[model samples]
Target chain A: MKQFFIKNRISLSVLIAFLIFTGISFFADYQPGKAISKEYFFQFFKEMIFFLPIMFVLIGLGDVWINRDKVEKHIGKDSGLKGIILVMLLSMAQVGPLYGAFPVTYLLWKKGASVRNIFIYIGAFCTIKIPMLTFEIGFLGWKFSLLRTLVSIPAIIIIGIVMEKMVGKKDFTIKQP
Target chain B: MKLLIAFSVIAIVISFIADKRKTFSGIKSGMVMFFKLLPVIISVLIVVSIVLFLIPQEMIIKYLGEESGLTGYIFAAITGSVALIPGFIAYPMAGMLVKSGVGYSVIAVFITTLMMVGIFTLPIEIRFFGRKVSLLRNLFFFIAAILIGLFISLFYNL
Candidate 1:
């Protein structure tokens, strides 16, 4: 029990902090505080409900199905432009928040994806998501959306290269918990 | 959401067909990963809620309006970095800001940083990528957002 608690300490503290804030809000402003907290909590909870399970299942499936040797053969350190483009397309097609990319990227790293490819994947995931781009075009107009997309492609590549150089292959190993 | 559901269903079918035992083990590991991530998720949600409550839409519109200049850019970048609003909501809000006379540059900075540089998500990031890489990624994105904003300003003559 103690060991479990220790492992979960951060979560517990955050829960406590949330309760304390909610309590304070209730005491200080009563109706609005309760209403605000409830509204926000439920909104996020709904998103979690919809997305989290799918993300986990997909990660699980990827883990089980993907072969490390095959992955490494295609996208290893010397894989170059082909590997980078493949990773970019994969990330662009991804369907969740940026946080959802973490485990997937970790799996890729473990499977021996180049550090540059991993970083590029992450960078593309953050901005070039297909659904998000459609929404962006709807709201901001196609010109703005297209311009940003065009600019971001090269930007992501440059950032990936810079990050690989800075972090080096030695630091690319996934850290064990 | 429909896409996710469809994908999940397909994945389930594929997993079961390919190898039942490995699929179960995969799910078990995925559950472990989920439990490990739960705390971070809950904490981020709570923090995001509090932030949304504190910074109303009117405030964002007022501060990011055309006359706000460099201060507007900085403010937008910071708020966008910290805010956890999803892209669907964020894009519409940026649209409203644009209609309200907020500069394209400001909106660019806001949207870029909102997506790229996640301050609140840093803890989870550190957990996955380690402190150095997480920090560096955020830092690099922050700089990229500023440059992107500048590029938009020059391109559109804003």
Candidate 2:
């Protein structure tokens, strides 16, 4: 039972937090803050509910079907510039939040994708996803959108390369679902 | 977004029909991951809510708009990293800020870090990439965001 509590402490803490917050809100006449926080929480959750499940399912399918050799050849150490471009393009095209991409990234890791490519995939995923870019362009203007993109490409790649240099040699523990 | 969800459903259906065993295994794995991720997601969402209520977007413009200097840019970047505001609302708020005379570079800094850095999502990121990689990635993005803002200012001026 103690081990169970330890394992589930994060969840239990959340429950505790929820009760305390509710008590404060109720006793202190803090209804507006509670209301606002609840609204924001649900909005975030709405995105996760709609998007994350599909991402996980798709990643699972990819895991089951995708061959390790193929992923390595395409995005592994020897994959080089071609690998970088592939990862970048794939990330750009995907439709989901950054957190949603984490499972896909872990799948890539399990399939022998290079550290550089994995980093590039994440960088591009957050930076260049097309729907958000269009929204960015609409609000910020084409020049702002275009210039940021041009500048970010190199920065993303550099981050990837530098990260590869840092933890590339470390053995990764493959945590199972 | 609705279309994306619909497409996912169709693909799931196709996969399920093609091979029940593979589909079940895929879904089971997905469910396992879903449960694993839920706690982290809830924690962040709750915190993001509290921050959103506390900060109140108006204070953002009031602070940065008045300064219009290095400090403002720094504040913008810091805010971007900390706040979990989505792009849709952020972009429109940014458009309003531009109208209200916040400089291009400051907005650029905010947007760059806003999209890239995720202090709110750090737990989930750590869960996936571990502590070392997650911190390194956020640090790299934070630095890159500031530089990108500077670059935009230079180019637009030139």
- Report the C-alpha lDDT of model 2 over B1-158, residue by residue, as the tens digit: 87777877897888888898998898889877887777667777777887888788899878878876788878999999998888878999999999998888889889888888999898888887878888989999999889888988999789
Give the runs in model 1 whose Cα sits over 4 Å from its true position. A1-4, A20-29
Instruction: Give per-residue CA lDDT, model 1, range B1-158, as digits (tens).
Output: 79779878988888899899999988888777777778777788777787888887778777777447777888889988988888877998999999998888889889999999999888778888889899999999988988888888888994
Error of 2 at A23 (Å): 7.2
Error of 1 at B25 (Å): 0.2
Q: How good is model 2 by TM-score?
A: 0.93
Candidate models: Cα lDDT each = 0.83, 0.84
Please write out the lDDT profile of model 2 over residues A32-99, one tens digit for every residue. Answer: 75675467766887887878887888888877778999999999889999999999998888876677
TM-score of 1: 0.93
Residue A57 in model 1: shift from native, Å? 1.6
